[model samples]
Target chain A: MDKNYNIDEIENFLNQEMSAEDLSSFKERLAQEDGLQEEVDFHATIVEGIKQSAELDFRALVQDTRKAMLQEENTAAKVVDLNQNSKSRVRSLGSSRIVAIAASLALLLVAAWWVFLSPMSPERAFASNFTTPKDVLSAEVASRLEETGFANNQAALQQLQEAMLTYQNDNFEQAQQQLDAFQAQYPNNEFAAQAAYYEALSAINTSDYETAQVKLLDLVDTPNFALQSDAKWYLALNSLHIGNIELAKTLLDSLQSDSKHGTAAQGLLRRLR
Target chain B: METSTIVEQLRTGNQQAIRSLYQISFPECASFIKKNNGTNNDAEDCFQEALVVLYRKVSDSNFQLTSNIKTFLYGITRNLWLNELRKRSKSGLKLVMDEQSDREYILTADDQVEQKQEEEVKHKLIAQAIQRMQGNCKDVLINFYFKKMSLREIAAKMGFTEQYAKKRRYKCMESLKQKVRTEYATLGL
Candidate 1:
């Protein structure tokens, strides 16, 4: 596609350096000629690839800035810790005048640093408000396992139990595996829906937010899904985690009117706003 | 800062601009990818790709700010993450290598794999061609074309006369064209 236009023409067109007449003609050609439009699109895509790489380079610069800021904060925190520990050691030995003055100065410095540096970021708010929802199967489902036809779903329920236990034991990897197996075996059954919800939680625990979002979104659409409220809550948290503050706010707004999650949703909405 | 101002700052390579944009966009996109079994690094990569897409659109000569920047950014980020997920799934390539599978996974290179491999080769060749550019030629070309620097700005930055910068830029472009032709022919791209 790029072969159709010379580099200079491409550059001129991209930069809007072409004459007004030339620009008009070019736009007309782009509109009328499929081949020309395709060429431009192809060139644009390549340019986009290069630009994306360039943006990463720029992002690296920002990351360096953030890293430096964090390092400074850490160093300051360490100094405060060291000073506090020294103050304690000195107090245990003797309440010397010199140690007293040093401790006061150290405390003053720590206060000053805290005052200067502790502005709350949206990310911090998200981290503070977000809690992983529990993945336990319902007692009703567990009791129903003894009935006929429900016996057929017992293996899936057992798998769910194992998955929940593994999750509680912090064996998230195994929990994810068990959930996956349960879902596959019990597809189209209620156990599968439960497994999918747990699967999303397992994914979140593992920081696999994409898979978790997918599963959660699907669950939200399911008819009379038991975990729908929990799914919506976590989905909102997922939005917050990924820095979509507006989306998080919107979701929380919707949930503020929800009977079950309304209180938690209202609390989060205040923080977000 | 205003969105337009932030966009302008980004065009000029401002680190603070990137930081502001990152704070807004990274969390949601990162979470999306993470939920999809992507690592933080994978999320970072996808977010960067999405930013680039947005940057290109924003920096276009005829571009207009029709949508809210955040909405536009989120849309692109979602699409990019989804596309990346699809690609990873199709290829069965984990963004983060699975050590357990790594030991057992021997790639059975089919036509699709071969084609992908060849495309990668061609990409590298194109990159090499750009890399092989000499001195100010590379700098001038990158500044003018990629960085969208004006000839005068390039001249000032390169400490060369504007005429010399213009001439060198054309020469550098010609050299790139020649290199592309040669390399593509040699590599059968």
Candidate 2:
């Protein structure tokens, strides 16, 4: 068995590029040789693996495209809903006079905005950009429980689920407490990073900027944290909430290249500048 | 788009074609799934799996579409959701079967679905191995293999000579094989 066998030979055999005589000879050698079959199988696996990788990438593209289409449909539906609500309200009013008054009020509000609004402040920026992170952990935990039949980490997953449910229900302070307890009890759990992340988000939602900032900093520094980019973005927003404009700017600069947060960060940076 | 054109575009991984497929097929598929006690997420998953199955089928040079693309997709999604429902609850399967009996087409077999799942697991292992490779090696192999780039194109893209690109691809492939070997060994496969 040659250590440096040409990979192309295996590829040619697998692809049926060899002549009939050459393939016959190769098959005979494969039968006679001890390791040649293994080598060929290994090469075939690599080839198939590469093709599968490409197919997986294509599947991802399809999924992403579907998501984008669904998002567009949702946005369009929202616009239609708003239009219908406005139309019903207008019909209920049933008065051209009220409509005129509303139009005048809108112009007056615009004039007031032009006359009295100051430059964007850090607090205003934070308020404009910050949204409470959605409770993703609940669904993840539920799916894991379903897959594993609640056999492993049942207690931990249930606790995480309870905390996520609290967060989802807008019980931020209680969620934070529950998350802290989960972290303390299961510091080395596979989902500990996720718990830490939601804990920080809970603090931020409750206007406890200092606590949130500390937790976000820890998350940003944690290796292999799946939500590191998200932590960085929220940490930047936390800095803005605390009037740490310089820190916010620095963090936002770092996030300027992040795919999910880059455009938002760039927009926020421009406003800050 | 025509059915044949859509299939061709999907075979080539066209995003617009995928979006069109979603717009054309998803609403009816979602309605069917929802009627059968499946959520929007389940509908999405089944639909995506159907698309993958369609892509795989059409990738074969001998594949011929016996039905319209939408019909084909709906059949696959229906079968996939039924398979999922059966897994989730056998009691629900009777009700689903009652509803599904009216459908004229069921494109995929249970064994084929299982095969796809098995292939998915294998592909994921390979993808993980590729991810674990060193950066340059990973990039070269991904470019040459997944991206379907020729050695000359990869060389120009990576700003290396063609000869270097060829050698680099071979070495990276060997590295990937070693990584996959370790993965198989770890799983005792």
Candidate 3:
């Protein structure tokens, strides 16, 4: 701002390029001299001008990259599409661990999500195709069912209890119709919840263990409705039976923590050990 | 990492390298692009071209280091932006400036020569001011002002009362101002 002021020194001082003593001396000089003020204002203006010129245009980059990727994909399509036929004949299965288990089980390779993966509902799976672990009931409970002869309504509940009993006897497919009727009638009940497990076992028998495992988890962990501890063990056992070592180990470990299931599950874990 | 690493990786067509370089450059570039009446689109093109130029120059290996990476990037970006302005003008896409709105821009060589010194000083002052803040004050200010976090998000994430966060931010800003004024009094507006 001062025509006669040395712009360089004031620029250095104001921008703090000046050393401490020099900055102090410059500040003293500024307090006494109006020339330094003008020079600093001028220098700051120059810095602002240069700073204002700096910018980047990334949208243009993305547009260019997209064009390049599209071209690359076009070239790649000819090569990649040729191999599509072979994939149908033999699932590439990729590098995931789930594929390792599925391959051992000869699971249905189609992309249709016949298997649910969420851990929340494991029972609807079991009652659909497999045996419910009647072994989980205490002796008194088992005797009570035998005495009652499972003859409540003799309709949905009776059929469900019968199917559950037959499943306990390992008559998995024989229990299917009864379980289905029971599931439909008492959808919210524990018996209906266990229907999914039988469905799962049926799928597994057909080598569709992927779908079965999902249902097994629900049946195994029914909370205090009389099946939680049993469900976890069964889920773990099936996970192992199907060669899902990781899941099997996790469930088995959890079962080991519950004193009731711990004795039996620990035995299984020891065998695994 | 060094900007040259970005230059090298970009030359090899690494998309992540391209991403990182652009992300790091975004704040500085945004302010500059906004000032020039250029949309974010223009800034991106200029940035890519700057990256391309740097990538091309990186093979020399003997390129003298004259300035901090940000300053070097700023310089290159400045050059490319000026070129973009010229090209856009020729195509008549540029707006003609009104005499009153066209603020006089003056450049002095003195600042350019001493930019590194200025940066070192400013950076230290900023660090000092940031350090002067309390944990909660710093957290609010850094998240809201520097990191551009939303107020609602900051409150939820930090589990702070929203009113308390607001108070902290104001007090923090005032503290920063006081600190900057105390330590570097001659930072003329």
- The TM-score measured for candidate 2 stands at 0.49
Query: Against the correct fold, how does model 3 do in TM-score?
Result: 0.26
lDDT of 2 by residue, B144-187 (tens): 65555678988998899999999998888877877887888898
lDDT of 1 at B189: 55
> Across residues A226-264, which tens digit of lDDT does each residue of candidate 2 receive?
898898899888877755566677678767778999999
DockQ by candidate, in order: 0.09, 0.21, 0.03
Residue A191: error of model 2 in Å? 24
- Candidate 3 residues lying further than 4 Å off, grouped into runs, are A1-154, A194-208, A267-273, B1-189
Relative to the unseen true structure, what is the C-alpha lDDT of residue B29 in candidate 3, on a scale of 0 to 100?
Answer: 73
- Which residue pairs clash in candidate 2? none
**Candidate 3 chain B lowest-lDDT run of ten:** B94-103
- Classify candidate 1 by CAPRI docking class: incorrect
User: How good is the docking of model 3, by CAPRI class?
Assistant: incorrect
Give one digit per residue, the lDDT tens place, for model 1 in A1-273.
Answer: 334465566656876899999899888877897677655544444443334444445555555534433333343354356556865896789777987899899879856655555444566765776666554574555676767786667776776777778877777778888888877777877668878887888877887655566676667667789778777787778656644455556566657768988987876665555
Best by DockQ: 2
Q: What is the lDDT of candidate 1?
A: 0.66
List model 1 lDDT by residue over B82-135, tens digit each.
Answer: 556656668644232123332122333233667657655555555555656678
Q: Write the per-residue lDDT of candidate 3 for residues B67-180, one digit (tens) a residue.
A: 555665666777667556755665423222222322222332232435756755655555545655667765665555433456776788789778877677666655554565
